[model samples]
Target chain A: MTADRSSGPALAVVGATGAVGSVLLPILSQRADVWGDIRLIASARSAGRVLAVRGEEAEVLALTEDAFEGFGPGDVVIFLTPPEISAQWAPVVTTRGAVAVDQSAAFREDPEVPLVVPEVNAHAVRIRPRGIVAGPDCVTAAMIAAVGALHAEYALADLGVSSYQAASAAGRAGSEALRRQLSLVAGTDLGEKPGDVRRAVGEDTGPFAGPLALNVLPWSGELREGGWSSHELAVRAETRRILELPDLPVAVTCVQVPVLAGHSLTVRARFENRVDAAHAREILEGAPGVVLVDDPAAGEFPTPADAAGTDPAWVGRVRASLDDDHALEFFVCADNLRKGAALNATQISELIAGESA
Target chain B: MTADRSSGPALAVVGATGAVGSVLLPILSQRADVWGDIRLIASARSAGRVLAVRGEEAEVLALTEDAFEGFGPGDVVIFLTPPEISAQWAPVVTTRGAVAVDQSAAFREDPEVPLVVPEVNAHAVRIRPRGIVAGPDCVTAAMIAAVGALHAEYALADLGVSSYQAASAAGRAGSEALRRQLSLVAGTDLGEKPGDVRRAVGEDTGPFAGPLALNVLPWSGELREGGWSSHELAVRAETRRILELPDLPVAVTCVQVPVLAGHSLTVRARFENRVDAAHAREILEGAPGVVLVDDPAAGEFPTPADAAGTDPAWVGRVRASLDDDHALEFFVCADNLRKGAALNATQISELIAGESA
Candidate 1:
């Protein structure tokens, strides 16, 4: 099984039938032709299913220890599993000398695991002593590249972000739950009065704590003490780590909107020096992995629907902060399934491949 | 025409059948039993419709010059009409010696007309040289009380706010439009991909610039140059004026969410002195017109659904910025039809009654 080093790394995709995995398969087929054998691994129930990638059908393998029996040191495994699954499987892959690029939050804070956004901190990928490159949670990965680009030139001092996250951020189950809830309450006057929403969407709030169809829920992820949600805490930490601003003054409020795919954020950034809308727009338009769609008069700005299925983080509504000369306010949106989760993980794996070769 | 001054002033509600007026009439009846004659006036089409107030059916009258023909100095008028109607009729009422409390943006920036948020700047009500007091826009009025309360203690220097505005902020038509659009797209597999929303909600986006059923539209109000919406600019100006920080740095983004009644805001405030979340929570808890709900672990934070019929602005998610000791970040939600529009207007009228008596 010794292929030439130049033949490229063997890619193994764990949780290949999950939400991000479904999205990642198409992206992998479309973007990375450098992989030798693209292996798809899922739970036992999905193991016999065939998934189409790059115009070819790949049989999904059951994700057990025996599945990786053939995996070698030259292999790169991308995990799109739950935190518990990643916690169980990631070390096993890395122990077999394969690089594990995890999309779970399980190993993100580990000192030996390099939490990375390739565009923002590719250098961190090379320093992973645990052979693990942790992808940011979908919320942070959605906007950090664009935010990081601005911070690079402006010396970002503080960030205030309000996220309008999509249903798919919680994966396939979350999306299905929203769809089910929407069917129960849509076309009805559920939002007309207080408790009306509660009455209409009774006992069917789904994976979300509240009904998200025709409504916005201010809390996301697991609830933490002092009214903090785990998603908000993770976004703050991930963005801080990716931008290398460990003490970055970042206040994030994660609110789940009814969008199915893209995650949208309204960001207020304070810089060390004055920044104008024109200069910010110029920088954003030319920034890597960022698309600036800002012409308000033409009714042009990024929305979750507009950013859905897109790879780049779309930035718009760029304005100079009227209250602070050093601050810039803008909106950012990206596909939660794409750049926000799967693509970023794939990019990290590609970085490892380039380095190992 | 004035009987005993102890009997209280006459109250006329122009545009009484409109969305804000409908909400205001109920609040007026509930809060102000002092008003003598509560007149309900609307356009000819709605003139004959009877609306219930204070447990009685009040007959709506046509909003004509003749409607105010008997109005005198001892009378107080509340204008919940659109800006155009307010511009035409607010001056007419003032000329007839009646104090006009306008909820519309018609007189907000007029030098002689003081824009009043009673809890924040009630003294401004007595200084109305034009015989008119203006109320803040629904968006600003919803959150200013909480922000103002904190500012009174800490000297707020800068503000960044992102508003999660509801459909009713655009009036009854806006709410109806959202309902219709939601019926068309919700639970229908519309928001799964880019442009899927547009394709599904075709030609039914209504008063909104885009489909607002399950999607969050970043643009609100009429578009302005440099991508600022009119609502954002109005909030900035009104907030600065009410807080008496004439040059206060304010950056606002008004986003239309799918909620029906409550308008929510995420505010980041920088003060002149360091403020902690615990201290901020204490001030917010005792602040007039604010209900502090900060226990996130019990899912106790406010959402639009929770604030739908409430009078007070619900405040929560209070967190002191880790980067700036002087800055505080929090979330606020209020009934857009109540505190945002009608109740503030009603509060201003009560001020006129107490002074004129």
Candidate 2:
């Protein structure tokens, strides 16, 4: 283990040039009082790139064990890399005594690693026996925070959700690829015939199975066992873990929409007891970290355009289920980069720093 | 009443210059053996336009009482017009002794006017005592044809559905407006911030509350009492009517995606008995007007791109809900014009013509 540092926690941000990282740096700078000495680290190829943060320029450093050399027990190392990279480096950093907060699927299911959403399960962060705290996937992070508040008040029985995911959730390459296809088909009359848009955007489909310019794809993540898409399984697993509903009956169908930032979901949630829309709206309105924008007649409701770049989950369209007295239907949207990924990691990092202090 | 013609039933198409009409014309020509003389009729403003059908030019006639002058018993007039126009003209044609196949919501809820999805409830078409047969809405037409087949074998108790609707479901103006907004935002970096796309497409939000380019609107049709959009109400009402489940418990959340033609839905249905994926697939593969394309590893799934201009509802992503033995989840897609609107109306008209013959 590395020698302990008596000073306040420093932050080493791995994958500092990634899609979520780009958004993370800005948020960190805006919440500058949360830490001391922030280190920007990325792959060797992006090491020399300069990024602006809080009116200061920081040159990206190559990611390696040496990058965390000065990061001791009091310091926190945050990983925003893909699953493989996170798996490799999480133990590396935590072994050297610095707490590792992983934003990848690498260690999310690890029994010793605490899978956390600050607003939903901050207590889970304190029980990190492996010195590793794992944030939920982008979809789960947004959904859990929104519903966890309600779950805390009214015990949830089961959940049925359909997601409208944005392109940015696939990272920078995904957003760029979706934009390229949009530009290609935006000028043509490709939406008229079968496979027209798909043919027009051939090979530029980019991280998606079909053209998303004027379409929605019902699949996300790699195909997995039992015919579940990686995303479908992840959503079910992570949400179940974070909500502490070990055996919760959660049904999730993830669909990729053309939005570039926010991830939206339509939720039909059943509670242990009867729930009313007005009371539910009241709970959501007063709930911390959730914005209630559900006045439909006034044209106020959550949309990706309204939620992008925001930290709070925008909750709207609250109505009691027509057939069930104990259920409610609502819509939720959060900036996939902010609350869904970067901000949640930032929140977890701050929680660790507070504990150390 | 107009004089009864001994010649086989003449086919008259109202709203023959709209988006569904543009698709309906070709379908009618391809199925030319179903009719004798075909009359194209539209509002006065669209009269005199020459449209080609069955390799022959047909002049558009002004929609007036005289437009149906020679149409009588055994003759069928299909109304592909707006709900308001269908409401105004449906009784006029039916009173003149012509079977009026209305593809609008105006007559759908009327007990005498059967709302039919041909594959699901063709027998309901014969019970149109008011001489008016109404087809289901675009979203319902696509989904009912898919699920109703399964419901026939396994009784459905409740359904949870979320629709990913195409812009053309809003008709030509809606689609043109959506395409225009898409063109405006497709070239801009408008998705990174709140209201950026809305600002970029200022005042071009046309028919929809917000810009649909690279985004989705959670509400569709008019905002109704109890905060349910007209679409949400229509989906529940129509699905129940077509499936012959007068009190079937259905929860629907309709979101307008950016697709131009096909409407897709993710449905979770609770049945009266146990259901499995393999059996469901086998059932769907042989079900009339349903195409089973659920092999995900081979990347065979339904998207609007594949369903556009297709006649059958493409079913995919079938899985049994993990917690419920009686529940099944699946995704369905179909051309909103072909099966959703024009084709269903055409089918109903043919059924009426066949009975009269």
Candidate 3:
């Protein structure tokens, strides 16, 4: 059955019950009405459930071969599912003639599948040979908008990033686990001694390596080669691809903090030319999708708590490196479920929609 | 009124009522007995208080010009006081012929004073021209052991560090503020929105620039010239001085996390020689004052909670940088009060006492 094309192209959101998808639904409703029909698709478990989108209740559809029967050409299907799921189904969605804008790591490293950060490399989306546009992971997505803006003005040469990632970056399970762990540790002095927190949070670490309630875990994704976590390498690869600096000399350390939402990153970037802090601040002040909240003297700087539920990546603690005139250091935070995943995917879909127009 | 030096040299601990002092008293009792009298000195407010040391209760003495009267040569006075207090009283203690081992930033940069990390620069304590031995700040003290160990093997060329500093790094008030804030926000689901945390923690941020509960503040210490925090520059300066590398390139970003005790750092170090992850792990495992807790596959890496109350700096997540053969990245954690402050001070004092013996 062909969906009506008179209104606009149809939009299908896979994994609609997941963390990123939950944020994406509200974002789509809140943003411009560019889609003809918003289709919510999730696992069979969540299929019969009704969710609110664009302030209207919509019944979720189950994932199957027929899910994308009528999603063709101008229609955009966004997969906020796990990598294996996206890898298996993204090709199916694209085979049906719809462009799949995947927010999974599966296609991000695929050269033919353009990794898009709309503000940074929206132009790359037009040349997706695999008919799939991949979005950077939450850590990279949280800071890329600001990093890209700075790179534009200063010509970024080398990048070093350390992330304070939110539990939600691991999906709903991670957030729920953190909440559970917090309840177990709240109003207690569990963090004072060795293994005390672990003893209190016995065997319920959820998606993390250990109890993340009163502690910061340095390990993020699966351990990759050379002891780097997959998430760390993804940040490096995604940043390189998005900024078109394949050999940008990027080093990243991904750590999971106890935060429930926003992902924060401390970025150290070396530029080809001498960088001025004031000029960089001015550039960030005017940059799209970047907010400069950097008045340290007045107690103003981006914290995950302040940046959560926000769309733009909040940048602060801006300073030129003391040892290198060409380097700049700053802290940035953005809601992992929003700008870090949902909004970036939404923006890419909008770009594709505009292309069809 | 000279202390009986028959048992050993007299030891004075100023700021005995403060955070670091609270930890120091326990350390003195636990370590091998090396002193005749363990003097507890604090402000007049805590002058009447008694604290335990070497299995006995010791009366706290008020800070005065005469507090050092009985403390002469062969005696060591350890200052865990604020910089201003140390600056005001260290000379007095030294004038009476006692060696003053200060854990404040006041004398750290003094040309006549030697900044010592006993494990790294124990010999430097022998040449204290000002009769003052300065200890590095908590953040620097926490990671220098591991960094110094690695440098000894590879000859470090450049350093980049991002800290997950604990609340206690600011002092007892910072920890109290975090506990109070945590009680306010715990189990209430408050971190999902912007300023909700700030609203819940109104005017109760204590020593921090903003709410540290469920948030990470990128700024620590006083804002310095060129947009650097005093704490960040201190890490750079202290690391350089302790390593005896005056021209080493170092960059640091100090951030306050909600963890109550231990401080964590993600480090990127470039060495003159090529680094191997397995070999680095072997080196760290055998290095003095360093504990290797790596092995991400088994869910064993250093987290603040696990490292809290420990004397050794826990090093983990060892990996040679994929891009640079000479660079290595790792995460390290240490109790900010113990290894980061109290223990380091005690170790320096031990060295000073050994000098007289």
DockQ of every predicted complex: 0.66, 0.77, 0.80
What is the Å distance of residue A329 in model 1 from its true position?
0.6
* Clashing residue pairs in candidate 3 (N, C-alpha, C atoms within 3 angstroms): none
Worst 10 residues of 3 chain A by lDDT: A1-10
lDDT of 3 by residue, A159-257 (tens): 999999888888889888888888888788778788899999998789888899889999888988888888889899989999999898989999988
Candidate closest to the true structure, highest lDDT: 3
True contacts kept of each: 0.70, 0.71, 0.80
Per-residue accuracy of model 2 over A1-357 as CA lDDT, tens digit each: 232344457888999999999999989878846576778889999999999876689889898777787777768988999889988888888887889999999998888999998888888899989899998888887778768977887899999889999999999878998889889888788887987888788866778877787777889988876577888888898988888899999988989988898999999899998888888889998887899999888788899888999999999999888888988889999999998889999999999999978
The residue ranges of model 2 lying beyond 4 angstroms of the native Cα positions read: A1-7, B1-7
For candidate 3, the docking band is high
- Over the stretch A216-261, how does candidate 1's per-residue lDDT look in tens digits? 7788877765456788888888888888888887888898887788
Identify the superior model by DockQ, candidate 1 or candidate 2: 2
Given the true complex, what DockQ would model 2 score? 0.77
What's the TM-score of each model vs. the native?
Answer: 0.96, 0.98, 0.98
lDDT of 1 by residue, B1-357 (tens): 232334678888999988888788778768847787777889999988998887888889898877776677867889988889999998888899899999888899898999998899999998878888899999899899999999999998888888888998888889898878777776576786889888877866778888887678899888776678888999999998999899998899888887788888888898998898898999999999999988777767888888898889999989877667888889898998888888888888888888766
Indicate the worst ten consecutive residues by lDDT in candidate 1 chain B. Answer: B1-10
User: Model 2 lDDT vs. the true structure?
Assistant: 0.87
The sequence of per-residue lDDT tens digits that candidate 2 reaches over residues B1-357 is 333345567889999999889999999878845677889999999999999877789899998898888787888999999889998998899898888999988987898888987788888887878888889888888888768988988999999999998888888878888889878888678788987888888976778877888777898878887678888988899988888899999999999888888999999999998898889889999888999998888777899888998899999999888888899989999999999989998888888888867
Q: Cα RMSD (Å) between model 1 and the true structure?
A: 2.1
Alpha-carbon shift of residue A297 in model 2 (angstroms): 0.6
